[model samples]
Structure formats: C-alpha cells, structure tokens
Target: MVLETITRRRMIGISAAAAGMALLPLYGRAALEAVTWQGEAMGAQASLVIHHPDRAKAQGLVAATVAEVRRLERIFSLYREDSDLTRLNRQGFLVAPPKELVDILQQSRKVWALTGGAFDPTVQPLWEAYSRHFSTPGASETGPSAKIVGERLGRVGLDRLVCSPERIELPVRGAALTLNGIAQGYVTDRVVELLKAGGIERSMVDMGESRAIGSAPGGRPWRVGISDPLHAETVLKVLEVEDRAVATSSPYGFRFDSEGKFSHIIDPRSGATPQRHASVTVAAGQATIADAFSTAFNLMDTATVATVIGNSEGLEAYLLSHEGKWRHIPARTPVLVSKAL
Candidate 1:
C-alpha cells in the first residue's frame, strides 16, 4: 500500500504541538526516536518508532523492533518468490511449517471466522492479479472477469484451510496467503511486548497504519489525528488513545486506474471494490484485530457493519463517505463530531 504524505501545514502544526508540549518539565526526560528501514517486507515502507527515557534504551528497543519485523517478514511476505507461503501455494500442503507460521495461521483462521469471511488471506490471488496488472501496463491485461473472480472468491472459504500443531495445508493448489492484513499488527504487539519486558513504559510505533501501539511518554496517551480522506490536508478528528490500538482502511490508500475506478481493497463476496464508505477506522484492545476488522467493516454493508460493531465489545468504528459525511458508531461516537453539526 502507498503511504500518504503528511502535508506541510500538518507537519508544522505537529511540530508546534510537540514544541509546546516539550516545555513541560515531565516531557524533558522523554527520548523520542523514529527509524525507517527498507526490506522486502510488507511490500513497501515498513517503519518503527520508539519513545523512552534514555537514548541507549531507545536504540536497543529499535534494534529489537527491526529484528522482530524482519523475523515476521521472513515468514509472511509474498515478495520473495521462494518464501514458505509461495511454496505452500504451489504444493498444496506444507508439512511442518515453522512454529511462528503455524501460530499466525491458526490465529488468522479465528479472525476469518469472526469476520464471517470478510478477512481472508486466501485472496492473495486476487491481489496478485490486480497488482501485477496495474504495476505493469499492458502485461497481458486480462482482468479477472466477474465469473472468474467469483470462482476465486468462492474458493476463499476459511474452512478449506486446515492446520494442526505439526502441519498446515491448503486444500487447493494456487491458494496463496497474504498476511498484509494482520502481520504488521502482530509485529507491533511483539515489539510492545519487547519494550515492556525491558521496563520501558511508553512509546508509539506506526508500521504502515496496520501496527500502531503504546502511548507517548509522561503518562499521557498518544494523540493521533485521523486524516480526511477527501482533502488529505485536514484531519477529520483527533483521538487520545492509551494502551489501545487503532487502524484505518480505505480505498483512498490505493487505486488501480488513473480514473480512480479500481481500488485495491476488493470485496470478496461481490468481487468488486467497495463503494459504500470511503474509509473505516476501528479501535480495539489489540491492534491486529482492529486492523483486520477495519478492513472487514469497510467491505461490509451498513447494516452488517453496524451489527458487527454493535456485537463487538469494547470496539469503536468511524465511517467516512465520499460526500464528506461521517458516521460514528459505538465507542467512537463520543470522540467524533459531525462537521454538519
């Protein structure tokens, strides 16, 4: 996914806010450090940030964070054609996958069930088709027709995937898996666990929006401004979150065509890009679940999305449409204000 650039005004405002907050005595000891690392992981722009009381500790934390991301990337990335997942997709069943891969696959199955197929890693073929077609112009430009996309979607049933403590198998060949939806969040959780184990109290990490964790130092929650989907220049809302995770998914992130007709987020049920809502942000106890559910809710209809959010305990969601209208459901209602009001 393409990372949206933060505008000049937003950067200036954030700098001013940071400068003003830094004047406080408590903020004096906090060490804020950010690092950008390039690897063949997560397709593009995998990053990590750490805030702590000492530069040495922050450096160690960042090192551990990078190591963790690289470790997970080795297991989950599809960029490497020789990766375990690629082999599995080619060979149908993989015997004795590494312990980490097994655990992630099992957890992914749970999310698949919870979202009622809205979150499916088996959609990798669809992603592959679109990404390859769009990235390279005139590369056999055979778009998956409605029938073929439907067939692939039908094959995306979570029940088709089987796993045991010792082995994992895909019932069909060419059934690829992409952890783009959940792996980053898992990495974030791991890094947080690492920092906490090291006795670091507060921090913030944004792994391309899927994985954002912890709080700023000084006993205060991290302040995050939700970007306006249409304008990109303004923030729709500001959120105060401590010890929680937030994720946003939208068609605004990527489009396959210049006319902005084809989006990367394809609705599995319909085999089409979702046009119901421009974007959806979900806040939950775990960043991984929040990340998956945010993308799931974006593909769902209004009633389905509402039911999912309402039934979910301690989950908050915000939906923005193309017409500049917004809807706040459940826990987000208190923090979000309608511009119309």
Candidate 2:
C-alpha cells in the first residue's frame, strides 16, 4: 500500500490531509487557551492542538503524548537503526516481539483482507528495487523491468508472514513489512487516547496522521482541507469533520523520477505504480482505517471502493481525478460534508 524508504518515502507530506484549522471562536468565560506542540515522529512532522483553560496541564499532556510517540517510533520507524522493525527486517524473524508490533501487524492483516490484499505491508522489496533503479544515473523512466518486479512479487505476501504472542516470523526470505501507511494513523489514534485520558475533550492530534478528539472550540466542526495533487499549495476541497479521522494518498506525493510516474504507493498484488486517481481521501471513525484505506483505495476501482464503503458504516472517500474532478463515495452523507474550493 505505502512504502517507507526513509531516504525515498518517509511520512508523505501530501497525505497529511488537513491544510489548517479554521478560525476558532474566542474563549469566553471558559478561559480556554489553545495549547499547541510541534515535533517529529516516525520521520514526519507531528503536532498537537489542545484547548484547555489550564495551560500547564495542557503542556503536561503534550509531553506525555510526545513520549508515547517516541515509544511507538522505536517500534515502527524505518529510519531508526535500532527499531524493532529494522531488526526484524535484517534477520527475517523477531523473537518475543513487542505486543504493539504484533497488534499493528494484526490490524494490517485485517485491512489487507478487507481491501483484498490492496493494503499490504510486504511491498518493501518493491520499494527497494525502484529506489535503487532511480538512484542510478540515467535510469529508465518506465520503471523496473517486469522480470524484476515479478521476482520481488514472489517474496511479497501477507500470508507468508507468521505472527503469534511469542514471536513473529517472515517465512519467505527477503520479505519485509512497512507500516508507513498505517502506523502514523495508529500513532495519531494513540495520541488522541492519551489526550482523552488526560481529560481533553476538544483537540486535534496530528502525529503524521490527523484525528479530532471531538468538535473544535465552541461546538463547530473541524475543517480539513484536501490539497490538489497537481498543485500542492492549492486546497481543492474542505471537509467538515467532528470526532473523525481523515487521511489522503496521492500518486504525485513522491515520485522516483522527475516525470511523476512511479509513486510511493505501490500495488502489492501486481507490484505496479498507481494510475487510478490523482488522490484518494478516506474518512473513518479511526485514524488507522482512514490511513490504510486511503492508501488501499488508490489501487482499487471506483465500483470496488464504493462497495467497500457501502458495506462499512461511518466510512467514506473522496477521489480526485487527474482531470481535477472529485468523486464522492455514497454520493451523500451527514458523517462528512465537503465543499470544493
């Protein structure tokens, strides 16, 4: 679904989804001040916005959130040399794996099935092959040869991965996992949990992905802007969301070549670069679902994506075409409302 070659594709900026928050109503008698914190997590910029009357308490919450993010990064970060993921990829097996690692893998497996293998984490080798090819001088614009892709495909499959309470194993040699597509959302959700546990009812957690703990200040819905793939600076659409998570995936987010053909989002089933949409934005109750489905929906057709959304409650998508047209799943809904800019 999504690849995280730290040098090639880290936490993609394009998929960070929200442009900025709308103007907030000033705090009245509540005396709530919006406390903000910005930092880095899992190789991407991260931030938190909390509205609290007590700034000191909010700062403490921010500290706890940062600590939690660093803890998870030690497990999911591909850039961290000593991360559990790095050790597993280097050795092909992990003994007594962390419960968090196993839990995310299990969540990945569920989305892998829900999207019919579109949300795969075993596409790391494909990323390596393409990154190597593009790094060479005068590489072909057409991408890696079919033979090379086929060979890499042979080692890519979630079914080949074994997971249990005690250990996690990759049966196929060279098989690896990249949680770039899902881990950020997992982290965002976790931050929201921490903030909620700290008595924060209205806040926005942007830990690579974004999740609103509740409505914005003064009962207004949070506004999330979706940037145009052709023009990253242009916010093509805006979504009014409350107590929901939004994630976007764009083929133009990261390209191996200057022509913008090959992308960081790879179709694991065929080892092919996505050519379906300029971008696919998914909104769900959980940031994890929004993030994974945003990446997976790029590999699926409109009908298939629509069906998946139809079958699931509190799930919707907005697909932006290269032609600059927008397509919405379910056609109408109250969970998420969007206005084209």
Per-residue accuracy of model 2 over 1-341 as CA lDDT, tens digit each:
12111111222221111123232322212123555555566676644444555667767776787798889999998888999999999999999999999999998998898889999999999999999999999889899999999999998999779999799998698888899899989987887787777776665555666676566545566667777776666677777777888888888888888888899999999999867998998888898989999999999989999988877778889998888888988533456533333
Residues 9-100, candidate 1: write the lDDT tens digits: 12210110121123111212322442223333345544333444455665676677667767777777767667777677777777888777
Best-performing candidate as measured by lDDT? 2
Tell me the alpha-carbon RMSD of every candidate: 6.2, 6.4
Lowest-scoring 10 consecutive residues by lDDT in candidate 1?
11-20
Model 2 misplaced regions, further than 4 Å:
1-36, 47-49, 54-56, 331-341
Clashing pairs in 1: none
Q: Tell me the lDDT of model 2 at 83.
A: 97
Instruction: Assess candidate 1 and give its TM-score to the true structure.
Output: 0.78
Runs of candidate 1 with Cα error greater than 4 angstroms are 1-58, 131-143, 210-215, 230-233, 332-341
Candidate 2 lDDT (Cα, 0 to 1): 0.75
